[model samples]
Target: MSWSITLTVNGEPRRVELDDPRVTLLDLLRERLDLTGSKKGCDRGQCGACTVLLDGRRVNSCLALAISHDGAEVVTIEGLARDGALHPVQAAFIEHDAFQCGYCTPGQIMSAVGLIGEGQAGDDPERVREGMSGNLCRCAAYKGITEAVLEAQRRMGQDGWEEAA
Candidate 1:
């Protein structure tokens, strides 16, 4: 049975016929929709290469089923820009040199956006590190990534001081 699924992706309405209940959002975005920014690193939720925003929360798209997210709002790396202007996180990544080889950058930026939106980027490098630890970068650009997130938080009027427990 083919089920029709409607979802808002990258601020655009997308409707597709899903024939497999086990097909994940990542596959739908990459294979079906041709949105290939999200990589398939681990494909088992162990790596954050497929991270995306599900209604403003960060989730591993590889573990999220397209059928389960019917009518849901999904944001991928392709949605991180507006009118050719980069999102603050994207700019921060570039300005801070947060990525090398750039395979994990999309997921890293997506996770950072969610963290900042949740008020978790309050100048605490440790917390930022902890929050972003799920997204691994084989290039070992942790310092740049952390700096970019902190810079973005500061730009958003955060105190830039370590968050108090």
Candidate 2:
């Protein structure tokens, strides 16, 4: 029973045909759309490596079924750039050296973007840490990640970023 789903991906409209009810958004993004930036750290959603923006909110793609997101907007790491320019969050991550092995970078960036987009960027390190605790980096680059997100909030002129939680 194949079903059709239309979703805005990375600001682009995408229509896909899917049949398997068990097919998750992560699988569809990686296997079908070839958007492999989001990693599959833990398929059970324990790790935030599969994080993506669903309607401007952070969600674990691995835990979301493609069929369930029929008309939702999805933003992957590939969609973070515009006209050869990096997003502010991406630039901040690079500038802050927020990643080590880079495996968790995409997720971290996505999560950060969500936090900022939701007007949660703030100066409170503890709040930032608590909010970003879902995304784990095996390389233990947490300090850099926190710094990058905080810096991005500052660069974006986003108020209350210093008090996000």
Candidate 3:
């Protein structure tokens, strides 16, 4: 039986018909919607490679059933920017060299955005690292990642980042 799911993705409302209820949000976003920024690393929830903002919270898309999240607002890495400007996290990531292979950058950036939006990314680097522990980078860019989050949090504060959240 096909199921219909409506999602406001990256500020655009989209209604999709799911051929199978087992399809994960990641699959639906990538396969059906052509939003491929959220990667499928482990295909399990262990890795945050498929992280996305669901209803303003960071969720592992791989673990979320598309059919269950009808009417939810989802934000992927592709949606983090405006006209020609990068999101604070994305800009900070580049400034801090937070990515090496770039495979986990999307998830890392998304998680950072959510963390800052949640008001959890304080000035403490350790706290930022703890909050971002779910996302792992095989390239061992933890230092840069932590630095980027802290920097982005500070920048977001000055730029009125609440709307992006």
Candidate 4:
């Protein structure tokens, strides 16, 4: 049965019609809403490539049913930047060269954003590593990713981000 859900995506209200309740948020964002930043690396939750912020929390979008998150505020990597300025996490990623293939960058950025919001991504490299363990980078860019998250955390406070909410 088809259903409709009104979600706040990237601070904008989005109303989507779903033909299947089983449809995932990843598909909804990529197919329906055209927010393809969240990749489809592993459709299963094992890969954090489909990570996104849902109601200020990080979740594997591939495993999240769109209907289950109706009315939730969703934030994708595309939504992170505003007014032509990159989010701190984004800028830090660029500075640290956190991505090689760029396939997992979006999820990494989103997960880093969520990690910061949850007050878990600290200046400690090990802490950031543990927090971001879910996002796997085949390029083995863990050093860059860890540095980026740490730098972002040091440079910006949780309040500096609106999309992370």
| True-vs-predicted CA distance for residue 102, candidate 3, Å | 0.3
Q: Write the per-residue lDDT of candidate 3 for residues 97-139, one digit (tens) a residue.
A: 9999999999999988888878865798988999999998999
TM-scores, each model vs. reference: 0.93, 0.93, 0.97, 0.95
The Cα error of candidate 1 at residue 101, in Å, is 0.6
Clashing pairs in 1: none
Candidate 4 lDDT, tens digit per residue, 86-107? 9999999999999999999999
Q: What shift in Å separates residue 43 of candidate 4 from its native position after superposition?
A: 0.8
Give Cα distance to truth, residue 54, candidate 1, Å: 0.5
| Colliding residue pairs in candidate 3 | none
What lDDT would each prediction earn against the true structure? 0.88, 0.87, 0.91, 0.90
Scanning candidate 4 in windows of ten residues, the lowest lDDT window is 156-165
- Candidate 1: residue 60 Cα off by (Å): 0.3
Q: Which ten residues in a row have the lowest lDDT in candidate 3?
A: 156-165
lDDT of 1 by residue, 28-89 (tens): 99999999999999999987999999987999999998999999998999888767967778
Flag regions of model 2 displaced more than 4 Å.
Answer: 158-165
